[model samples]
Target: MDYHNPNYATSLYHFIPSPLFLGKQIAPNAFQTTPKLHILDLSGNAGCLPEHPELSSMPELQELYLRRMQISVFPAEIMSLKQLRTLDLSQNSLQHIPQGVKDMTSLTQLDLSDNNISALPPELGMLEPSLQVLKLDGNPLRSIRRTILDRGTKAILKYLKERVAED
Candidate 1:
């Protein structure tokens, strides 16, 4: 269920256990405030836009979870969070990486698993300089062959080197 009101500061939203939702549109400016709101959890709510109300203008927001939301495109405006460090968009319906994601230089952990993405944008290498953990297991990418994994650190090192050089 969706709740909307100008004076309401904080409220508990319902948990929808449905696996798929299509065509749900959330009001974008319902939680407008001065100090900034932090932490948003929209998991299990598939088809909800990542750029929903209260999320786009939030200045202090740090952690965001849109996993299993069946999102296809990422919003470029989310890059405005200079203080943002964690983002989880796994289990969605994405097919490509959003170009604006490269703007998030402070991100540490990224979860992109369980999606239909087949290839990563070459610019993703730019994130190698700051990223600590990357989750890309469920993608349909066919380039990373098992032989590459057998090569161990050398393979990863080469991948990183190429990524850094690509920048």
Candidate 2:
């Protein structure tokens, strides 16, 4: 795909299939030309993203799907997107949620399921104001009990908030 074309300059959505890159790192310049993207789905591309993807170029991005990307660490670059409402990082290799997640104040939905996460950051509780949907299923969480996890997002947020208050 010719990313530099004028037609794609104002495009608000883009989906790059995994087969196209064959697990190779996506070029840093791939999304540099499309700054207005609101929704970008680069799912199923294992290790296609660098540790810190150059997503700062898309300030208007609202929903980003990076499922099954084999990412072990949280992509700190996403913290710059204050307009982001939904972020899907499920099915990755993430081991923990970072404190920087509190910076994503606009996120209403966050998916971290099917990962190796063992605990939820207390800072995540701060997002309770805007975050409505939090998926932690298929994880091996030890910090939060099963009851809270089963009670759903609200309960999980409450638990985390209490933990934050304790510290």
Candidate 3:
């Protein structure tokens, strides 16, 4: 799909399937014109994404799904989405969640399962009040014990919060 197509300027939701961006890097301003976009799903697209996708322009974006995008590093640009509620980056190649994630105050759900993350940043605990769901299954987590992870989101958040307090 041609991202520059003016026909998608006011689109609220945009989805691009696999092979469309295969092994290609998404342009930094690919979505710059879609200011009204609320949901963007680029799942199954095995490609390299820019360090910061041009998502800051879409202030109303609530849910973003980049599952199976072959991402290794967390995109810092996503932190600028103040109104985002759900973010799914599952089935990627992420190794760590950046401390900057705390800036996403409106996130209610975050799915980082099936990644390579071995440790989670304590800053994640800051979102306990607003974050209702966090999925970390399928990762090689060493910072958190299996029992805590098995206890579900509440227990996981509590454990992370305790770690933050310790610091």
Candidate 4:
């Protein structure tokens, strides 16, 4: 499942190498035989992926990729891992993030670009405490005034404060 290898190349649209153990779900007892893993790629498997508790048991998991998985709702269970610092949910069908997502304070980088998010909850700014970079480039939001974006991210930060503070 490690496509990050320096020599990796592919002609197919999408694929990951084997023996790295990529699946929709890893049965509870399945991971006991393997050493603790650092990276887990679950991209494109959310639909068929079983809602298993074991998915979050990897104590050393740092990076998670779940792009284009058609998951509309956020998985709150993954937020419990204090070790996770990066999360990618690009190109999914997510329109709204569950409230519990604010609990993932360990995240330094988060990608939610190209989803169907029309409006982000005010709580999303709470991520700023640890969030260094956030991507919301392609969404159907109809209210971003040109002046706001032109004003730079300060405008967005102010907007998030006003919107979430009201909640």
Candidate 5:
């Protein structure tokens, strides 16, 4: 499902090739048409689309899969989906998980494995009591200790919590 090709298969939209050879396209308003769309799986696109398409129109979105999108920047635009419970951003080029993620308090499972993420915002500590599963196994984290990461989600969250307290 490579969005870079535009002809990729998706459960929602069908893409037909246009003569336009636009460098890169970000459909900021694409999701607005389907306001009730809940589970969107855009994984394996391997496309380096920079802008986080504006998906705030869909308040019911519970799960979003942006794995392997080649996304370098954090998709802050779609993070507006406060009801999101599951978010997978694995296998991308992300270097940082923005502090804005703290607003998605409803997230229970967040998969950010296999990315270039170096450090996590201590604000991630705020997701506690709600966030139960966090996948950062394949990332090269700077602030978190390997021992804590090996201890799994609870330990990682605890580390984040402690960092928050120290600030």
Candidate 6:
């Protein structure tokens, strides 16, 4: 319907750094009004905000874009979105690939490119059955050779699964 109505706001494209709005701009209870929200873009809001606890409230979200948000800690709360299909956390300061990611069973595409990530969790193998795309380019992965990553999704996933079986 109308964008002004909180119930109708299904998508929000906020380029302004979220730190400026934390606690001051958004009322703590405001997120409850939009239960249908599916897409959220807060890309480029880097450094100022480290952890966003508010995202957990939006369980209906499907596509979440947080590129360059500088979130070092994965918000396990965001994993509450069982409907999530695409998650873009590229170009941030993340180092570890969080375990909670395996719970997003509906995910088809996940982007974690261009970060400081040095290794990956074998639990990533669990996503192979449903995950259609996973972008891990630009990370300094040590365990898996760059040659395997260049071979693409099937190769990378198979390599991770093999590692899991060996462990």
Tens-digit per-residue lDDT, 1-167, candidate 6: 47677545445432233455543334445555556677766676554333445666677778888787777766676788888889899988788988667778899898989988898888787788788899988988898988998898878878887887898
For model 6, the superposed segments whose C-alpha errors exceed 4 Å read 1-30, 47-52
Candidate 3 lowest-lDDT run of ten:
12-21
Candidate 3 lDDT by residue in tens digits, 46-134: 66567777888888899999899889989888999998999999999999899989879999999999999999998898888899999
Better of 1 and 2 by lDDT: 2
Per-residue error for 27 in candidate 5, Å, reads 2.7
Best by TM-score: 2
lDDT of all predictions, in order shown? 0.64, 0.86, 0.86, 0.65, 0.78, 0.74
Better of 5 and 6 by lDDT: 5
TM-score of 3: 0.88
Taking the tens digit of each residue's C-alpha lDDT, what string does model 4 give over 86-167?
Answer: 8898998888777667777888888888998887666666766577767777877655665664564446546665777887
lDDT at position 150, candidate 6: 89
Candidate 5 — which pairs collide?
none
Tell me each candidate's TM-score. Answer: 0.71, 0.90, 0.88, 0.71, 0.82, 0.81
Question: What's every prediction's RMSD, in angstroms?
Answer: 5.0, 2.1, 2.6, 7.1, 6.0, 3.7
Q: Residue 42 lDDT in model 4?
A: 63
What is candidate 6's TM-score against the reference? 0.81
Q: On residues 35-148, what C-alpha lDDT tens digit does candidate 5 reach at each position?
A: 667787766655424465667877778888878778888887767898899999998888988888888999999999999998999989889979999999788898887888
Considering TM-score, which of the candidate structures 2 and 4 is the better prediction for this target? Answer: 2
lDDT of 5 at 72: 82
How many clashes does each candidate structure show, in the order listed? 2, 0, 0, 0, 0, 0
Candidate 3 yields a Cα-based lDDT of 0.86
Lowest lDDT block of 10, candidate 2 = 12-21
Give the TM-score (vs. native) of candidate 1.
0.71
94-159: candidate 2 lDDT, tens digit per residue: 997889898899999999999999988998998986899999889999988898899999999888
**List of clashing residue pairs for candidate 6:** none
